[model samples]
Target: MSGILSEDALDTLFRHARTHNAWQDKPVSDETLYKLYDLMKWGPTSANCSAARIVFVKSKEAKEKLKPALSAGNLEKTMAAPVTAIIGYDVEFYERLPELFPHAPEAKTWFNWSKEWAEQTAFRNGSLQGGYFILAARALGLDCGPMSGFDMKKVDEAFFAGTTVKVNFLCNLGYGNPDGLFGRSPRLPFADVCQIV
Candidate 1:
């Protein structure tokens, strides 16, 4: 509770974080990856179901498996990044709800083996954790490249053959090459984007 980022640190986390498309050849150490997970795991989840599953692609063989699945335009960037994470969601995430939501017995029933309910909870909570992953990566001084332009079936076949984890998205991460970035894109204005309700 005593640990908190300085104002400058907080600003840098939000302001400097960008959708990186290019990366330096430097490797992302396992230590840093572990720390990134540690930071992100603290973010809240519904019933603490914590459904997100991450597969880090760094080996040449793993990257090769993913290459044919990517859009032609995205292949280069996806291959170039030091690590590409296959973010996934476990369909049986509620099995752990007993520990996560210890006070509530009925919570586990919400995300049980029923496909419809399980799919909804897994996708919703898993996507929330994905956002947490990006924030944690930025806070740890890593760049992020998030994309939805890949073949989901190929990805699932390659990474989740015998598992219930379904692919959510792909994220390429490492140190970014700022010189290679296009101009910063504009965001929707707050006036047009939010409601005071």
Candidate 2:
């Protein structure tokens, strides 16, 4: 079994990490983005569905395309970020089950039979992958700002039109500007939010 991660690593991934609203002038390189995905892709998904798709919005042209879809509150920060990742879920992701879940060659048939089930599985696993993306970014020493304040329909039309992918959420990536941070928010205690049963 693997040993527990050290305190420094835990703090880097969780305790000391903050959701950044503003970014420093530093840019996130394309190589870093590729490495981020390389790490996050290993996160598990049900039946190995691996349904999450991502569009890294880095160029001015791409950011402009995303601007109209953003809520007023998210517009400025997103545009200022070095990168904004549009996480998407593919409705037809199950078709790749034969390749992703090779142990169960017929796994694709399960979701193919029911549109509702397929959609559910895609969203569920896609969201899980999005979580993994966040942790992976943090591990790579990048700050993240995840938001759902954009218009989903507009995003889909702008970025995923004519494709089976649908927007899940957006996350901005960069080195954070500490001056832009809000006060640390409180969280529920384990006793209040969880049980040992």
Candidate 3:
């Protein structure tokens, strides 16, 4: 059984964590990016259908390519970030079930038979993985600014053209600039948003 996390750990992962809009000049190394993925990949997904694909846009050229897709609100901060992660959903991810879900060799057939079901599963699991990505980055002492304010078609064309992968969302990763943070937003109380039933 897993032991409970310390209060400090919970604060780092949730309570005090903020969506940063500005970044310090520090860079996030390629090795750290890989490590971030290695940690987040272990998060759960339906039938273990790990369908999230990620692209770390750290180069000037790549950032420029992504610029046109960003909404006006996201452009400046995204460009300033040390790395912007393009979290995408792989529609054909089920094909890998033979390997990812080796215990059930027939798993791929379930998704292959229905394009609609496949698409839903991809988007849902991909979004879940995106959440895990944020937590993993935080655990590694990095901050995140996740956003959906972008032109999906443009992002798909720029990053995943002729491929089964499609952009789900974008997350800027870096050391956050505290001066850029706004007041924390309020959340719905547990009684209002959850139920014991």
Q: Candidate 1: which pairs clash?
A: none
How close to the true structure is residue 143 of candidate 1, measured as C-alpha lDDT?
93
lDDT for every model?
0.91, 0.97, 0.97
- Candidate 3 residue-wise lDDT at 123: 96
lDDT of 2 by residue, 1-197 (tens): 69999999999999999999999999999999999999999999989999999999999999999999999999999999999999999989998998899999888898999988899999999999999999999999999999999999999999999999999999999999999999999999999999998
Over the stretch 85-136, how does candidate 3's per-residue lDDT look in tens digits? 9999999999889989999989999899988899999999999999999999
Candidate 2 lDDT (Cα, whole model)? 0.97
Pick out the ten consecutive residues of candidate 1 with the lowest summed lDDT. Answer: 9-18
Q: Which candidate model has the greater lDDT, 1 or 2?
A: 2
166 in model 3: Cα distance from truth in Å? Answer: 0.8
**What is the C-alpha lDDT profile of model 1 across 19-114, one tens digit per residue?**
888999999999999999999999898888999999999999999999988998789999999999999999888888888889998898876758
When superposed on Cα atoms, how far off is each prediction in RMSD?
1.8, 0.7, 0.6
Q: What is the lDDT of residue 48 in candidate 2?
A: 90
Model 3: lowest-lDDT 10 consecutive positions: 96-105
Clashes of each: 0, 0, 0
